[model samples]
Every structure is written in structure tokens, then in C-alpha cells.
Target: MELISSAERNRLFESFKQDAFHLELRDDYSVPDEESPFTSWTRGESVDYSFMESWTQLIRSATSEGKTVRRVRVITEPHTPYIQWEHETTGINDEAGEDIRWLPRHRLPEGITFPMQGNDWWLYDDKLLAVGHFDDEGRVLGSEVITAPDVVAECVRVRDLLWGLAIPHGEYQP
Candidate 1:
């Protein structure tokens, strides 16, 4: 696959705004060192704060106008509250009719990381944000990436369920 430049990536970012829903895949959703500055930090994780701010504002508008946006995260533990906020703030519907599935990281055969291993992906829709790990199996392992649409559907289903279980930030814990 041909690599796209930062400018092209930015354009992809812009496309997210135009679409009613969007998806993203990242190593982790939150900015690293969120707990404390004292924590060790990664090398050169430059982020787009301004762009993220703009996106937040769009969320505000969307919520006020009652347009739903789904934010999904496929993580091992401590799922972010922003996901709940994103759902409640977006005023998403409870019964969004999406599928849900979970396959553990350990389930992933050993020896996989970002570049060498396939990266996970996120899918956002009017009612859900779905995340899936990407991978290519070694001759002795499972497939590298999720190429099947049925598995994708299951991931979406899982997102819908978790979204329902998640409560609005600070108000109540579901």
C-alpha cells in the first residue's frame, strides 16, 4: 500500500467532518501521559490539539442539534470516559441495532506490533464506534487483518452493546 503524506492525512481528517459518521484507528485513543507528567513518555507523539479542539466543537454542535456520532475503542482495560461523553454528547440512540464481538489480544498469536504487525482499526457510524485489531498471521499464526465483513459486523455489534452499558460522564456509571 502506498503511504499517504501528512497533508493527505489531514484531508482524510477533513473528510470525517463531511461524513455523518467517521472511524479512526490508533495505538491508543487518549494522549499518552494523561495520568501525570511524571510518567514516562513516548518519543515524538506530536498530536493535533487544534484539530481535536475543532472536532470537539463539532461534537457540541452535533449533540445540541441531536445528530448522533459513535466512538468505539477496543482496549484491554480502563476504557476512556470520553467515549461515554462522545455518545451522550452526541445524543445517540440506545437501540442502534449494531453487532458486538471481542477477540482478546492474547488471542492474537505472538510476535505482532504496529509496523510489523497490522494495526487495529476503528469504525464510527451514526450509532456506534467500532474498533478492531489488524494483523497478518505468520505462517504459524492467524490472519494479519480482519478482511471478513461478518467479523466487522460482529465488532459493530459489540460497540452498540458497550455504548448502551456506558453512562454519561460524571452523572452515573452504568
Candidate 2:
């Protein structure tokens, strides 16, 4: 399957008419751009977050146009260092107009199964999906664009369920 670069995937935001939803299923991600910042954070050192400006800008621009951006992160309790950091920093995303929620894995509905073989995905306007693929070391490889109705439908269903169940960023503690 052909994959698109993250930049290309982000471009989808420009054309999508309404909403963009992201489902995050990982406890840790090894994004290259975040390596130094994450290392610094882990070391208890103050670190610059300029690396996140580009993404926040994207969300800001899109949401300013009245488009909705949302995310539901499924995580385990006793968060990993990466997740702890992500939790601490989620306010930035929220401030940019992205509605982010957290759902502990244990709280997932019984018998529910994720589509796209359980990988993370971004759903745009409930019609298109950009499924994230990661290398063995957990670095993102890019995304595979899928417009198949069945797949998108299942994702929409999952999104609806999880979104309803997740706790909004400000309300969740740890």
C-alpha cells in the first residue's frame, strides 16, 4: 500500500470540510522531532517546545475556520514517561482548539475492536482515514490513506463510542 508523508497527511486538513478526529492507541511514540525535547524533559531539564509550533499552527488555522479537531487517547494507568509528558503538554493542543480526551484502556467497552489492525488513525469529516504506520522502534513511517467506506464507517463508530466515553483533558487526573 502506498503511504503519504506526514506533511501530506496534514495537508488533508486544508481540504476536509468539517471535522478531524485522531485516535491514539499507543503509550509511547518515538517521533524524531520530539527526541531531544523528550530527552530533556526526562532529564528534568527545561526544554523548548518550538518543535510543536508547526502542528499547533495547523490546528489553530483549521479551527479558526470553524473546523473541529479532536483526539481520544487510550492509555494504561501508571503512564509511561512519554505519556506523562504528553499529558502534561496536552494543554497546548487544547489551547490551539483541539479537543483532546483521555481514556484508560481498561475503560474501553467490552467486545470493541479497533479497525486498521489497531493502529492509530486520523479520520477527516467522517469520510477519509489516514492510518498511521510506525516502525518497530515506534517511529512513525507515515500514513496510508484509506477511503474505503466500510473501514471509515467502522472508525466512525469507534470514534463516536470512545469520544463519548473519554474524559476531557482538564477533567482527567493522571
Task: Please write out the lDDT profile of model 2 over residues 98-141, one tens digit for every residue.
Answer: 99999999999999899999999999998999999999999899
Per-structure clash totals for the candidates = 10, 0
Q: What are the clashing pairs of model 2?
A: none
lDDT (CA) for every model shown? 0.35, 0.96
State candidate 2's TM-score: 0.99
Candidate 2 lDDT at 113 equals: 93
In model 1, what lDDT does residue 142 have? 18
Report how far residue 126 has shifted in candidate 2, in Å: 0.8
Query: How does candidate 1 score on lDDT?
Result: 0.35
Off by over 4 Å in 2: none
